[model samples]
Target: MRTVRFSAVAAVTAAALTAVTACTAKSDAEDGTAIQVTAADSTCETSTTTVPAGHVTLKIENKGSKATEVEIVFPDDRIVAEKENIGPGTKYRLTAEVKAGEYEIACRPGMKGHGVRQKLTVTGGTTVKRDPKLDKAVADYRAYVQEQADETLPRVETFAKAIKDGDLEAAKKAYAISRLGWERTEPVAESFGDIDPKVDVRADGLEPGQKWTGWHRLEKALWADKKIGAEEKTLADRLVTDLKDWQKRVGTAEITPTSMANGAKELLDEVATGKVTGEEDRYAHTDLVDFKGNVEGAQKAYELLKPVAAKNDPALAQELDRQFAALDKLLDTYRSDKTSYDFVSYDKVGKDDRKELSDAVNALAEPLSKLAAAVVK
Candidate 1:
């Protein structure tokens, strides 16, 4: 789960109107026209505000002084697609399948705040034809997300129960187990906009006036404070309640073939930015557990989309398979048990070990980023 921050609605609306002229354009999946997005420190500018419903591509350049994030979002701020941590002066191509609707192209400089915005209108157009297998892949991915959510709740209950009972050791043991499903399916949960912050926000990620809740908050109390107080117990129950909301909402999350592919890459990004850095499970040092979960989730998506990706670009598919296997084997080396999540603690890992892991993730991420385009072909 990642921290979520939003800009004031009025400010976003005014900026969006000023950034782009409201104009209609005729374009479709076949047109292959790309929207040019330029992101700077205080502004987000889009070449056009309208496109026909189908596959949409953004050619993004970050002219910002700091790293930025770009997203295509609903008016209510649910993300359709996003590419995070675009370093200064870097370029990225983000592709997403969007239906006819009103949307916004948001650019968050420094990867914080609501960001600069431009209004986007997706006009009704002929649906892009897809292979029947792609549809099945989406169906299966939805089921996989649901199953993860369903499994997560009971484990979370056990964790919360341990907390309520004041059983610190039991709570600590259950913590990583409870988070496995969440780590696996975070991208789907993040599509909902509100759930992640409530259940996953870290103390540093919280905006002023935002109450600190979620797993990380409890994590600090358990491992850092080394005690579970009354406040921690109350937060434990809140965690279960928030996750229940996530479980109920999973079925309704927007899922597409490209989203699955993109989400797989996002999971790797999570590993690079959070898990590998030892920031995600800082207190407990269970970074490897989350790291493994993220990799498994990415693999599941790639495997589901492999048939189409392989057909479109056989070489890319072959490279992805090799890299994934290599990374998995490398991760296994750190696990003494080999059959469970019993990997070395992040703090115990040496600089060389961490570098090896980081290298493996980068090797896979480069090819995985191309999967979206292959599947959409």
Candidate 2:
């Protein structure tokens, strides 16, 4: 058996680690005080339990044999800061604007199991007065996510029907189109337990005793094996059903400005780590299409938050605009005549072009990570 190294899977795992913090590590601690946090196989050690309530930078290092991730969760279970995909000896920095309150620090080693956690207490800082504008932005973003879900539910039905009909040719065409809606709303889909897996789980990560199902399973059957069986039809039906249920539930889901900003950064991280590697659409060679959808979704979140972010921190807002535009322009060159992106198989993508896309995404993500902090300032 061949040892398959799915770099894209590893990247997704890494991106999940720091879903809360997206900014690049600062060269100088000019804006915030730096605190050291170390992760090992059994322990998550912080330099201090208490921090001033304001801009706080967590400089997290993995001193473990396996990949590790650290996250700071609020009393309400909201993530305020995190960094993931820290290799055996790697380090990352995440800066967050914090309120004076109790928080929790958690560390997951090898990216499995419930993480070791410790209490984190913030002091000597006042929470900012609540802003109605920021609240409205959060509400609007949720509505947008709900709207995407509403649009995607029907498309999923179409894709599933093609598979159920055993029309491999039609299924192949519908597969990519169906993914656009899901990709645009992936961050929210992920919040619905089991829905994301049922609709989009890749081949790499299957829970123990869990049979692999969903779109990727069907993708392999259709594209790799060139056969569609009863099993494929069943999986397709479940996917459409799951998506329908997911869309109904997402309308009233709780979402915050912090989550919106993090979602945007998360989507860019998806592009940087997975789509760039072409490992995401390995079977279909449709990674470019997925990449465009992820970027479009991220861009929407940023645009929705632009008003409040600009009011609080004009510099951060302007930087995001420039980076978003730069990334979009580069992505545009890959468009197919009939679609937003030209379909280039992962194996056929040039290294230079891959690097270009990867670099552009990272440039956007760094500034994007700072938006939540800026808005709360």
TM-score of 2: 0.78
* Global fold similarity of model 1 (TM-score): 0.95
- The lowest-lDDT stretch of 10 consecutive residues in candidate 2 is 1-10
Per-residue lDDT over 1-377 for candidate 1, one digit per residue giving the tens place of the 0 to 100 score: 56576645523455443454335544433425478889888888887888877788888999879999999999888899999999999999888988988999988877766878888988776656789999999999999999999999999999999999999999999999899999998899998878998898877788667899989999999999999999999999999999999999999999999899999999999999999889899999999999999999999999999999999999999999999999999999888866899888889998888999999999999999999999988
TM-score for each predicted model, relative to the true structure: 0.95, 0.78
Enumerate residue pairs that collide in model 1.
7-114
> How far off is residue 21 in model 1, in Å?
5.2
Question: How far in Å is the alpha carbon of 148 misplaced in model 2?
Answer: 0.9
Instruction: Tell me how far the alpha carbon of residue 195 in candidate 2 is from the true structure, in angstroms, after superposition.
Output: 3.2
- Model 2 Cα lDDT, one tens digit per residue, 136-206: 77787888887888887777788888888888898988887788877876766664334665667677755
In terms of lDDT, which candidate is strongest?
1
